[model samples]
Target: MKWFEIGLVVLTFASGIIWLLDRLFFAKARRERAGLLDDGRDPVVVDYAKAFFPILAVVLVLRSFVAEPFRIPSSSMMPTLLVGDFILVNKFAYGLRLPINNRKVVGIGLPERGDVVVFRPPAYPDQDWIKRVVGLPGDHIAYRDNVLYVNGEASAYQTIGQYVGKGRGEEMTGATLLSENLGGDGRHEVLEIESPLFASHGAGEWTVPEGEYFVMGDNRDRSDDSRFWGTLPESQLRGKAFLVWMNFDGAAGGVDFGRIGTRL
Candidate 1:
């Protein structure tokens, strides 16, 4: 994905430069020679640049600052966000950032508890991972007996029956579903596998460091999140996820239109 971002920035800049250069230096010559044997067409490269520059620039601006699309690749988020769900992340929800390096140019908002966010993991900066923000900077975070506690206050969980997932998420069926209220972030559903016996993987108390955040997945027992990798750095924050644009799981199922447009 880092490569993709780099390539996009390069392509957009190259196309824009080509188009601008032609306008300043080559366009007048081409127009002056319009009556020649040539079809009066701009050079092939210039023609392409003129046609694609606007489109590329628009996409770059939107993806870099307004919103960006990301597809869920694993079942870690479970019933809340299915595998193969194409989601729209609000890129500027946290701040305005440069495209490739993701350096913030203007700060906007901070990740709130319970908001689903996409970020580059500390262990793998090139990759993006999405999870729920559970603890903010300087907050006391703990996970014990499959329960999440923030600043010594336990989140409320109400039984929501068994999870019946679809497409690639079908394997997660029969897991216990519950509605969790993260005090400040509102309510969301989570899945816990009862039959397998819940084993707390990273059960311990941790104080979120300054300029970092603690995140976790809705599928409590299966997520590789802050519990395993430590707090997420503020600089690696990408955006807050807000919508599911599409879903396509090639394993036994294809597109699931029902998931499209789902608000996270």
Candidate 2:
């Protein structure tokens, strides 16, 4: 479990113990000693628990089951999501899962193609990764010559122009931009560098296993994704990113107000 989650659990447990002790033992003692100078009605621990318990519970519920905020750390999801974008992920969008452990307790829906999802890669369980879903379970996916083929149907994309990266994204300059249309899902922007396919280029065809998903980054050539690691397990999925609440691009300026409140 994460340290933050452990801290939350500690807070919740401590608060509950304080409340129960006050109700069962301290309150009766205070009532019996009402005539004494120290009645123990306003103990410091009880006051602190009363002040923070509800707030902590609400935050835990919201972050664990409702919505959680995450900051993009890399250029893997560029164009659609930037390096400094602070995004909100819907925790219950895929299903309701317990925090830290990530064991699902409620079934809501499953991820669809073209959906931007956050999951822990099987190779690296401690790290969190965000990518676009390209293939679902039992689907045939291929990436050859910078083209994606899903179930024998080649993906259609329109070349936009040479990608002009901005701010920290400037490092990705010279890449090509393409407006990719994932039929029935919607359209999104992707970036690809012009380079000859070599060994370790992360190109291949795979039939996704059951309860697994194939994910790739918007920055095709630069992303180390399922193309490199392998299909993501359904259990490792964290949530679906839906909105960009803030962007702090230190490389560009300090803060970019234009990207605030952008929906995914």
Candidate 3:
């Protein structure tokens, strides 16, 4: 089932307020009138809920409209994002869209060629996916011999050493790292695993239809992105991931100080 995080936040806020009002006003008044010294302390659950409700509500509003926090779960964006990295996404960069429904009420800007975007899966609209925008509306995209071609022009790539994933991503260490240039905008590092017979190695040419975009993960070999399911509709876009606020891998206790404040 598709769970709505924003809706959950609203419920938490409402419940907390009700609990606080009951304890501070009604309960206190009744106890005082009855001459009973005990005013019945609020339940532990109620206390915690009240304490965290406001904070979470503010976060939910900021996240749904201004910016949102997300964690990289896999190495699909390796070399750019680590598995334990907690990143921030710009919610208003694309447009002001309501969470859950994802209907863009305002059109602020269009997705650029080299932008890192988060969107709902076209095949599975309930699932959130992130990738780099390769082909915009009406752009032809193709991948041959692990090289990307956009609109009949090949993207530039230079070998940049090897990726050495550590901690949670240790298994993917020593993969090839390449400095990729997307249409001369900027250069970014990408991880490429040497896997022969990979399904995404050589994809047939695909033209992004109107109101659609073609995306691909930085980790070319490991991602199941647009190449597998299909292009993402414009309405499916969520936001643009931009920063890493925190990182906690669970296996590694408290926090990963290295990934904090890292920009995406």
Candidate 4:
């Protein structure tokens, strides 16, 4: 769990407990001592609780059940999501899961192909990873010769042009940009690096098991994804990324105001 989340949970519980205890045992005495039994309020601990508890509770609810913001840390997602983009993930889009534990208590929907999702990799549970869903349960997924195949049908894509990356995206400069239609979902852009650091072999073929998803980065060959760590467990899913609210490209020296409010 994130340290900030842990802190919020702790503050919420502590303030709530202080308020409850004061109301049950010390409120009347404190009020009487203040010389106005009917109108006076408990001063210190109770005041702190009253002021902070509600605010903390509201934040926890909104962040845990509605939507949460996450910062993109790497170029794995490339043109679709940049290194510094601050994105909002729809927490309840797929299902409502408990914070920290990430156990889904409500099943609202399932993941669809081409959906950008955030999840905890089974190989590294503490680290949050984001990728595009390529195969759903029972689907056959494969990658060969820089192309994707789903259930014997090759993915259709339109070559847009050579990607001219900037800032931290500089490394992807010579890559090919393709608008790939992953079927079911509308087309999205992806980068195909000519010379990949890691090559996909026969092991790239995978039959997605029930309650699992095969995910890949839009930056194709450069990503360490399902092709490397295997399918992601549905239970470890966080949410679907929908929008980019802010961006600060350190390699580019500063923030790019134009990227702010850009939809993902």
Candidate 5:
């Protein structure tokens, strides 16, 4: 039951191989016995396709349950993550669960504030989203005038400087860079666009209910995350994003060799 995806892949590959072998070897003999000329063309293409299916399926399983690859589509994570950065998520770090269903059959651990995580969008469950955990279950969270307050304790933010725009996204240009501290555990940079004027501002205090978490993007202005939708359920968590293996931005040209092997 747990290996359902793997099973399906294996079955499909086996069936294809049998069909290909039968057509390649036995078909000629049968055709000749019936006084027909054989073309002698081996249907290796079918076998190749069949083999590919299992390989793809294995990769899918590894990505979903183990580590998954993700591209920084937007500047939401900004300085910590770039528009073309390719990152890897630690799938089993939170817990091992069946992909798609997202039911946590194994409880390895829970998410803590300040951890960068990937989860299905609370508003749109079909979409996978990445954000930094701001509030855990039962914590009060609020954002006003671009400052974040958790449980009445304001997170420390020091003005670093202006963020220099790079790449093609409008979200990356003309933003303020600040070093944000999540209660001394970690320090990371976040971007706040000066022009936008904080669209989700003036929100009242949000008390995260049990079994849920409040999240936000590092690029404070451009992300559509927990601030707009809601808190992410524990079940919807995909994994903890921890590494960048490769980066490819077509507009910026080929692979980003410098970004490769960087830890998140």
Candidate 6:
């Protein structure tokens, strides 16, 4: 289990138990002794518990079921997302699940092609990784000549000219920016760098199995995604990432207020 989650759960439960015990046993004793033995004020511990339990419980519920915030630590999903961007993941977008185990307890929402998601990758189960869902279950996915082909249908890409990188993404400066259409209305921006020296760059092929998904990064040549680690299991899904609420670009030395509230 994640340490933050474990600590939060433990603290919330411990405080709640103390408050319950005070209400059930200690409060009556205090009232009985108020006549002569002592005053009726609750102990400091009880007071602290009463003050913190509600806030902790609300936070736990919101983070576990409603939505959670995550920071973008890499340039994997660049162009659409950026390094240092703080994104909001919709916890219930892929259905409500238990926090630690990630067992889906309710709802039947499944991720579609081109959905940006945050999940525990099969390569590193303990880490939270974000990538765009490129291939759903039973879909044949192929990456050839730096182009995406799904079930023999090549993805459409519209060049958006050279991308000028900002902040930590300065290394990716001058990469070709393109708009990729992943069918339906699932359109998103991506970054690509054309290298003629190695023609077949980042090429791969895979057929997604049942209950698994193939993910990829928008920074086609830079991301370490399903192209390297294999498919992401359905049980490993955390949530669908939707928005960037903040960006604290270390290279820029401060928050980039323009990236605030960017839709993913």
Count of residue pairs whose backbone atoms collide, per candidate = 0, 0, 0, 0, 1, 0
lDDT of 3 by residue, 211-249 (tens): 999999998888888888888888888999888899877
Off by over 4 Å in 2: 35-39, 197-200
lDDT of each: 0.89, 0.89, 0.80, 0.87, 0.78, 0.89
Stretches of candidate 5 exceeding 4 Å from the true structure:
1-57, 199-202
Tell me the spans in candidate 6 whose CA falls farther than 4 Å from its real position: none
Q: What are the RMSD figures for all models against the true structure?
A: 1.8, 1.7, 4.1, 2.4, 5.3, 1.5
Off by over 4 Å in 3: 1-6, 9-57, 199-202, 250-254
Q: What does candidate 5's lDDT look like per residue over 124-208, in tens digits?
A: 7666678999999999998977888988988899998877765555446567889998786688889886655575553567889
Local accuracy of candidate 4 as per-residue lDDT tens digits, 1-264: 467777888899999999999889987787776765455766677899989999999999999899988999999999899889899999998999887788889999998898999998987888888999999999999898888999989999899999999888898998999999888659999998665454443246899999999999999866889988888999989999998999998898779888888776
Give lDDT: candidate 2, residue 227.
Answer: 87
Each prediction's TM-score versus the true structure: 0.94, 0.95, 0.80, 0.93, 0.78, 0.96
Candidate 6 pairs with clashing backbones: none
Structural RMSD, model 3: 4.1
Model 6 residue 259 lDDT score: 87
Residue 147's lDDT within candidate 4 is 85
Which 10-residue window of candidate 3 scores lowest in summed lDDT? 31-40
Error of 6 at 180 (Å): 0.5
Candidate 4: residue 37 lDDT (0-100) = 41
Instruction: Between candidates 1 and 6, name the one with more favorable TM-score.
Output: 6
Instruction: Tell me the tens digit of each residue's lDDT in model 2 across 54-173.
Output: 999899999999998889999999889988999999999999998778999999999999999988788877777899999999999998888889999999999999988888899888
- Per-residue lDDT of candidate 1, residues 1-264 (tens digit): 889899989999999999999999988888888888566788999989989989999999999999999989999998789899899999999999998888999999999888999999989989999999989999999888878888888989999798887777788888889999989558998888774356656788999999999999998877899888899999999999999999999874788888888998
Q: After superposition, how far is residue 177 of candidate 6 from its true place, in Å?
A: 0.6
lDDT value, residue 194 of candidate 1: 76
